[model samples]
Target: MNGVSRGTTWRMYKKHKFLFMMLLPALVYMFIFHYMPMYGITIAFKNFNFSKGIWGSDWIGLDNFERLFGTSSSFLRVLRNTLVISGMKLVIVFSGCIVLALLINEVKAKVFKRVVQNISYLPHFISWVIIGSILVEMLSLSRGVVNQVIEMFGGTPIYFLTEKYWFLFILVSSDMWQSIGWGSIIYLAAISGVDPALYESARMDGASRIRQMISITLPCIANVVAIMFILQIGNILSAGFDQIFNLYNFRVYEVADIIDTYAYRIGLSEGDFSLSTAVSLFKNVFGLILVIITNYVAKRLGHTGLW
Candidate 1:
């Protein structure tokens, strides 16, 4: 029995050796970049001193966190901004992507479909910095194309970037536009995997295109939608920090700043690293809770879920 088990283990190892070899680079990268930096999470609990270093830093036992919550009035504001903006973006971004995928699926003309797909996907490759600059130019109060068109229509040029009420709107809209095509890729792939026979049957049953989409297409990809929703819900605290940081200004900070941005300001600008770490730690803990709850809900509902 022992000899048989040993031979079976050797056979299995030999069979999967190439697969293990293929995964080595990715495992090494994960260890070096992701897992290594996770050790810094401890700074959240410690009153970190540059001279003393991470290990030598004095243990403050939540004093940093106390300062973060008690002293910073903007803590709640930033948290609120993060959640609200992220929630809105998650809905709009995913909905837009799904809609684009469904619409593109319905296009019978192959040439036009390909052209539109390529054009939409092009924006995903552009950096947020470039997108921000382009947006600024296009929305410039004086010489922008948007203003030019507005003036042509005898309308006043609106300050889109600086307006408090409009900042979140602009952030969500631009985020959706930039990511819609790229985001649609997964849905499109899922749609492609769906059985064509389902569509044929729906057609034979006298279903219209919209009806077929509702009755046949959506149900087939429901798992994919659910999984994506779970993943998006997991990151509800992060609402495109890069995009907001680049596009926002002090004028719209009340509405535009999120936890990540506030951390940057307080930690880097104000030299309060310990407090910033606490804020970040708080965000991560809440994010962890969200992921756990979402995954649990997904599993109970009989959908594809994170394990």
Candidate 2:
């Protein structure tokens, strides 16, 4: 019996040796990059001083969180902005990418399809700083192409920046422009997996192109869509710090500031390390809770989850 068991173990190990080897790099990368950073989260609770170090820093408990939630603070506003912007981005970007992928899947001209895909993806490769500068130039009151067109029509130029009401729209639009094609890549892959026979059967049954998409294509990719939605829900607190940070200024803070940017400004810029750490911790904890809850719901609903 012992000899048989040893033989079975050795055989199994031999069979999976290559698979295990392939997984080693990814496992190590996750341990280093993802799990390692989790230890730093304790800085949120302590009054961290560089000279004293994280371990030797004094424990302030909830003092940082306390001051943030206190009255006369912009914490709530920042939180609200984060949710609104992130929620809108997730919904719009998610749906738009799927739709774009579907439309691209329908195009019969291969060269034209490839051209469209490349063009749409180009903006994503550009730096946000360059994008922001481009936006500033194009939307400028005097010299911008938009203003030139407006002047041609005998209209006054509008100030898009430095305005609270338009800030959310600007953030969402630019983000969408930059990300739409890149986001669609996953959906396109899902579309490629859809059986060609299904579309053929639909055509034989006299189904319109739109009907085929609605019934066959959409259902085939439903699992992918559901998983993406759940993952996006997990990051509800994150509002694209890099993009927003590049485009926003104090003039539009009322509508434009998000949790990440606010933390950077209050903690790093102002040197309120403890308070900033508290806010950072709050954001991370809520995000963790959201991801868990969404994943649970997805699992219950018979969808792919992040578990």
Name model 2 segments beyond 4 Å from true. 1-14
Candidate 1 yields a Cα-based lDDT of: 0.90
The regions of model 1 sitting more than 4 angstroms off are 1-13
Model 2 residue 129 CA deviation in Å: 1.1
lDDT of each: 0.90, 0.88
Alpha-carbon error at 178 in model 1, in Å?
A: 0.4
Tens-digit per-residue lDDT, 71-125, candidate 1: 8788889888888998898878889999899999999999999999999899999
- Candidate 1 lDDT score at position 27: 99
Per-residue lDDT of 13-55 in model 2, one digit per residue for the tens?
8999999899999999999999998877778788889999888
